[model samples]
Target: MRAIRITEDHAIDVIEARVPALKQGEILVRPRACGICGTDLHILHHGFPGTCYPVTPGHEFSGHVVAVGQGTKGVREGDFVAVDPNVVCGECRWCRAGRPNLCLHLSPIGVGRAGAAAEYVAVPARNAFAVNEKIGAGVAALIEPLACAIHAVETAGRLRDRRVLVLGGGTMGMLIALASRKMGAGEITLADPVATKRAIATRIGIDKAVDPSALGDELFDVVFEAAGAVPALKQALTCVDKTGTLVQVGVHDVDVTVPINPFNVYEQEITIVGSNSLADKFAAATELMPDLQKEAETLIGEPFNIWDFAAAVESMAAGHAIKTQLVFD
Candidate 1:
């Protein structure tokens, strides 16, 4: 088997490796399509929390079940599935409370275990949700990110009839805006510096897409910062209406800090919240994908072969596509 490996010294290689042995309740999947995410970039260049060195870096993926381990239920050989990468310790307090994203021992597949940037990857059968084959592998691979977007919107509470603003026009931002619209947001505004991104957002049913500088004197009931950039976060903070909520959906450096007005937060009754990973929304995202198939399809760009992992990373870093993926031959 061929697997893309990222070492601790920031080296990437597509090396011949042994197929992963499935444990009890695990299934071995032959990944057909995998999406490279920002987290993969972090794991490659610097490092991301919980990343295991020499790891295979692909979390957003869908594949066929080639083999099922003993005791595995609900999944079978030849079943097409999209996987939930977050592997939690079900005995943890957060897990027991149904907030597995915050589990004390959360070890996501790509970050902490071997992931799907290979010919075959092993995952707990419970993490694999059967998806319609008609959706195609590219869109099925999007289910993971869509689940995260759903969790982000879920963190925002009520959105029906609320004015919503999403910062950024990347895959996560686009999905967040789409999710907001699905949740009955009265109006959706997406701000991105790139004209191409704004165009894509507009084409995908965003109510309004404009340059960040063009947004003047307008505030939103629910503001989402999904760009994972400090500048976008700063902009999102100011776009929230009084008594409204601001959802932080972006990943930031551990040491990074941005200035905020304590007075405004207190006097205006602003609620600030942080949304982590998908939580328990993977199944819901799988259920929602068929309805969102066309829209999701528009976000995907031409895919690179799984062996061209470096090129895919470079393309993603260059902002060449809204969603960059790898396809198995």
Candidate 2:
């Protein structure tokens, strides 16, 4: 099989590797499409921790089941499925408490195990969810990120009849806005510095799209900061209503200071929530596939076949595209 292996820290090589044999409770999938994310970019620039590189780096992907492991039921061979990359330990305190995102062993499939950046991948059968025939392979690739968006909006609580202000216009940010609207937010505004991104947001149902510098005076009941960068997150606190909820969906590797003047948090009575990845919400997202697929088919940008993996990385780093995908032919 043709595979792109991360041979060492900050190094990648495309090689002809022997196909892996699946063990019990796993399934082998022929990779159709996979998307590049900010996390992948982080791994690409800064090598892995403990000097260990990912075996294969693509996590956000979708494929058809070519074979199934023994003891796996319901998911059979030839089922079209989307992969849930999270690999959680069931005995963790957080898992017992029903929040697996905070699990002690939350290493993901692409991070801890080999991933879909190759001609084929083997994943735990339980992590695979069936995708309907109506959903194209490109759109199915979006399920991974949309699941995160779904979980973020779920943490934000009811979107119907509420005012929302979303910060950032990247793939995550855009999907956050789409998910909020799908969940029935009455009024929503998307703010970003990119004119092109803002335009894209408005076309996809955000009530208004504005630059952060030119934000309006309207108060919001919920402010979603999908931009983890300092300025955007810092500005998020100021944009919501006095007693509003603020959900920080974005993540930054470095320390981010939130200077809370005692009076502001106390007097304002604001609620702050930090969101991570999906948990049981993977099932919920699977249920929401109809709407998610509708939005993804239209909102997802172009797909790229990996003729040259290095060029794909270079183009992604250059910001020449939105939602860059690498397909295994």
| Candidate closest to the true structure, highest lDDT | 1
Residue-level lDDT of model 2, residues 138-183, one tens digit each, is: 7787888888988889888877988998998887888888888888
Where model 1 places Cα greater than 4 Å from the true spot, the runs are none
How does model 2 score by TM-score? Answer: 0.93
Superposition error at 233 for model 1 (Å):
1.1
Candidate 1 lDDT by residue in tens digits, 102-209: 999998998899999999999999999999899999999999999999999999999999999999899999999998888898899999999999999988889999
Best by TM-score: 1
Cα RMSD for candidates in order: 0.7, 2.0
- Write down the TM-score for model 1: 0.99
